[model samples]
Target: MENIRIFVQKHKKVSWLVLIGYLIFCGCFVFPLSNERWSFDFEKAYMIILSYGILATLFTSLLSSNKSIHVYSISLLCTTVGMILRYIIEYGEYSNTINFTQINIIMYLGIIPVFCTLIYWIICKLESITCK
Candidate 1:
């Protein structure tokens, strides 16, 4: 808890950038999805955005040093929060009731750390290859 607080304090600017970037990225997709004339499939767009976010976070996590796990975690948090906010803004107008079920919330929030772990594995592979 204290560590997380300190980490946020130390990397405020980077964290903010990640949050805003995620929001904008998600918004781009949301706008098209919201259009009734576009014939856009909601599930497809959602999965695309989810994969894109995972890839984006993976790359960002790769850029962090081994000691910077907190940085990676913070970035992941920002990405998840931005995504939720985008969903809220885009869908809130249509639905009077929004039920945030535990499973739905977990699935939404869990993608970050999953990709972060993948990033760590990738980084390890790279380091091993380069060190040889």
Candidate 2:
């Protein structure tokens, strides 16, 4: 916990760049167009990204404490922006309207700290590995 905070604070600029870049570059993956209908399944897309993000967060965090926060934030922000952009792009192609709600905004904002904490804990585990 303390180490992650110290790391983040020490590398504030890099952290900010990492977050911004993650948010922007998430959608760079190529997707197959054969199952066009699957593109509309925003729910499935969100679940897939979140699931993978969590797993990645776990692995990366476990590998290096100083690296966990960066990895977690990158994964979370990337998946989030990727999913939202995918939804917007798909819906826009068909001229469909996507609804936004206050609850959604609140939910996203609420999860930020929770995810950060999860990442922090994973990073904290590094103490055990490095202390020896």
Candidate 3:
């Protein structure tokens, strides 16, 4: 508890970025799953984003290193390995669709990360320039 409070104080900008990013990021998946009764491997996304966001935020904040990388890249290299482990557990929710494996793998492993990392990288760049 004390450590968390201290961490929060030290990484205020990064913390807020993580919370907002997670909400927006997770909301995209959560909204469809809850409202429309449709989702595309929501579990994989939720797991990856949540874990990556938290772990990156904590680790980077601890080191007082790059907030841009922590918040925007959103834990870059941690992604691929985590996706593999998560794929084994939370995959196949969309297995009924055509080319499901190729599509989801491309999505979960390729496009999604690229898109997410790009978004955060841009935001981090802007924040670095504007905020600092």
Candidate achieving the largest TM-score: 1
State TM-scores per candidate. Answer: 0.46, 0.38, 0.37
Ranking by TM-score: 1, 2, 3
42 in model 3: Cα distance from truth in Å? Answer: 10
lDDT over C-alpha atoms for residue 65 of model 2:
54
**Looking at model 2, which ten-residue stretch has the lowest summed lDDT?**
27-36
**Candidate 3 deviant stretches above 4 angstroms:** 1-76, 87-100
Better of 2 and 3 by TM-score: 2
Model 2 bad stretches (over 4 Å) = 1-58, 61-63, 90-99, 116-120, 123-132
Candidate 1 displacement at residue 92 in angstroms: 4.4
Give the alpha carbon lDDT tens digit for every residue of 25-131 in model 2: 44323222113234436665665357444444443433455565565566566656754675666665552222233443344434543455464564466556786
Q: How accurate is candidate 2 locally (lDDT)?
A: 0.49
lDDT of each: 0.51, 0.49, 0.48
RMSD of every prediction: 8.8, 8.6, 8.5
Report the alpha-carbon TM-score of model 1 versus the true structure: 0.46
Which tens-of-lDDT digit does each residue in 1-132 have in candidate 3? 347759787878887666555544443332222212345586866776665445444443343434444443443333444444444444675522322345544554454445455545554455468757
Model 2 vs. true fold: TM: 0.38
